[model samples]
Target: MSTSSPSNAISGASSSPSSEDVETIRKNRVLSSKLYFDISDTMVPLIYSSSYDIAFFGLEKLHPFDSSKWGRICQFLIKDGILQQSQIVEPLEASNDDLLVVIKSIFRTLCQKLNLLPKRKTYFGNLNSSSNVSKIIEVPPIALLPHWLVRQKVLYPFRKQRGWAINVGGGFHHCCADKGGGFCVYADISLCITFAFMRLDISRVMIIDLDAHQGNGHEMDFGKDRRVYTLDMYNPDIYPFDFKARAYIDQSVKVKSATSTNVYLKKLDKALEVAGICFKPELIVYNAGTDILDGDPLGELKVSPDGVASRDEKVFRFAKEKNIPLVMLTSGGYMKSSAKVIADSLTNLSNKGLIDLATPPLGTFLCVHM
Candidate 1:
């Protein structure tokens, strides 16, 4: 022990880097990452890919969520002529380096040779990654899927949407920096905001979460950070009742179970009003969930289909009026009708001229300030 020199002691100390070094490493990763792709003027900011659907034998039925809902929504838009296939913007999967910019730990994804449906026996030959995600993902059903597929099919798309883009499959707001839960395997919202701050030179961001349940994930991640202003409207009597995270919300509007359509819309109007007056943000992340529809069992609210459309219009109008770049995410919807409702809402937004889903379809240039 006495023979240990200064250099030897320095080497023998913790091998991990300090907090400041870790932050520098994250920034470096963000700057070098390819996930923040350039949006061409021709492409609409609507981000989605068919691969976002998670179809496995009957295994998908294990959860009430419609894993195929993302594709269904796109189908309605494309088939109904609301949008053209050429207008859609498809994003590349988030690489390990890209995800590391915000996520503390995630499985090294590697999936190959997979099939879907009744003949779909995916478990044995396809799932190559570790199944030891129980410690990270609190939901047991989510852990059943191989870590690779969760990252590839479910989580990566979320990382691509944050500011001024509509990811048809994202809004996994249940995941944070250190942990993941509620079918969310990665902190996409947090990752995107980090990229916005670091690469896009964005100073302030606003999260307008209108999901049925509280967005505990982003709340926990952005706590004590002034750059993000969160306006969360959720049912207080639902899953993820995170009291600690509630302290971080700049505005919280609680819509009780079975609340009527008009009441919900009024509450939303006031919340938007307060949000506009309180803190104006350079970007708005809209978590537009269909779970609030009347028949949605989980959402437990009585809002009609028209109400959902009205809600979307209000938010889109808010962005339009304030001239803020807004990104909408399809968060949670357990029922089969959720897809149709969301598609209808987008059609309504275009009809109102709040967003030019038809006109040459240019993105708001979220990648850079210029």
Candidate 2:
């Protein structure tokens, strides 16, 4: 119940790069990056690593976030006979060079300055530092550790895999180019899309953010950029009340607190229809957060586990019907049941033939846009 405020340490006024500079730097960095390595034909595009789970000296328990859910999701899938452990693709850590592509210059500078401090001194210098890194991640203990440790343990796994990947961790939708918030320390979604634009040779991308909370990070980062289209359906009464960021969303579907599963799915069906007519994207990034399930302390919506599975099915169906490569990130769910719900949803996706783990070559299905 100890939730961090949305407006905590991050400033909404962080500077954006000039359009020309953004394109130049983002493209160069993404092209020179090593995170987008080739996967073998035998490996599925589902990206995950044991290192993705965060265990901050057992202090993570003090926060409301589920630090271990990422590993648990994979475990459930394996236990249920839906996937084999060897089938999952382990991703390379997103190095500083890779992150420079999408991260704001100011943030990069701040991180560098923090890294320069002596090991004897507290890296952050002040516990109440307004850096917004710890507050946004909701793990106050992280404020005491070195920034390098935070990046290695928490953020490295969020790097983009192939065009079609399920990052069992990372849906940090609240962080942006120059700021971090709502337990989101980095802009993984933005970074992923940028990598796709350059490495995957993708142009138009659509973001289907179905988290219980509005995906303000990517919205803020991609605001007014015509390359990306956002369809965010969230409970407006939740943590981040970012009206300015809301303006960036192409289609905003507001679901009130305590709304039932039936009504939520009905709205999603309509939203997908509207989105189809609005944009013809080559790729879809689905932020599938399970926090909306009933009894979740944060998301507050009343959707059942079955409803969550159906929601993912609809999104996958939409992408398949459109012949677009899809990248899914398990974003923003912290309840103990969050992992199980996501695993079940993935099982459902597999059962429906949306995701084929046993296929010899994932590229056959994913190379549609390429």
Candidate 3:
């Protein structure tokens, strides 16, 4: 058995638990966890680490997904003089205890597959079953590696960049607490929110999921919870045609395939307006996926590079106007240009004064100046 705390994972886990007990365990775990740590004054909330990139013996080439896109995004920011390498914060890995609270049942399943045999663990140190690994990433070759390596190389970066940080990777909205799929192995969004609720004195949260596909993972996890409100804009004709999850969304905006940038932005403005009136959240989680860009095989939308930048600016402005802390996750986008598109968007956010890499002057408005 793994050395991680399996008992805490099960406490108050059943369908019928007293609210007090649930709250206590959740708070206790959040308090004890190391994922939430203090950052130095010099570093910005933009979190990225070289470890975020996954590669081994050239196996990464098998998948169409750009595995090195995360690193490339940071590189572009540096090249453009918008971000400094020293200002980026490196996050601590989310230990098993930290993940168990949000992904209780699924945590056990992943561990079983990942820690298959004791001897394998000694040899590979982080071996996981290839069958299970292939399901989340959709890359067949990744399963051949040891599970420990996958966690260290792929999942750990996601765990580290959870709250108030723009993670270069993660936004696995397809995987839920009980299952994992659609290139998502862990419920990082759910985990981040849960930690915030327990540790950060935050109660209400808004999820602005602008990925091409519906964010079914977070939808499934937070659907019943009243504290979270989801604004999902996706192509209804694409993968994961989940009608059940759609019911859970607070505001659902469907943009058809090949939708122009103008049309997409117009609909987003309306959606954000409606969301503003419908709910007031303490924090905003922006799932900024670039798959909607033109020529993307999966997203099928035709949004240009400038459109993506505008979209991010709008969301940031929304949060800044409300003065709510925002956490952005670069979710799904498969094309090679996806990294450049994302980098340009971040640069746009900085240029528009929506987000600050360096410390800003007091009383400075985060919204765009008229």
Task: State how far residue 55 of model 1 sits from its true place (Å).
Answer: 0.7
Tell me, by TM-score, which candidate is best: 3
The whole-model lDDT of each prediction reads 0.74, 0.76, 0.76
- Model 3, stretches more than 4 Å misplaced? 1-19, 104-128, 145-161, 358-370
- Ten contiguous residues with the weakest lDDT in model 1: 108-117
After superposing candidate 2 on the true structure, give the runs of residues whose Cα lies further than 4 Å from its correct spot: 1-25, 106-132, 145-163, 362-370
List the candidates' TM-scores in order.
0.83, 0.84, 0.85
For candidate 1, the C-alpha RMSD (Å) to the true structure equals 8.8
With candidate 2 superimposed using the best TM-score fit, by how many Å does residue 78's alpha carbon deviate from the native?
Answer: 1.1
Instruction: Tell me the tens digit of each residue's lDDT in model 3 across 206-248.
Output: 9999999999989999999999999999999998998998999
Error of 1 at 144 (Å): 6.5
lDDT of residue 112 for candidate 3: 53
Pitting candidate 1 against candidate 2, the one with the higher TM-score is 2
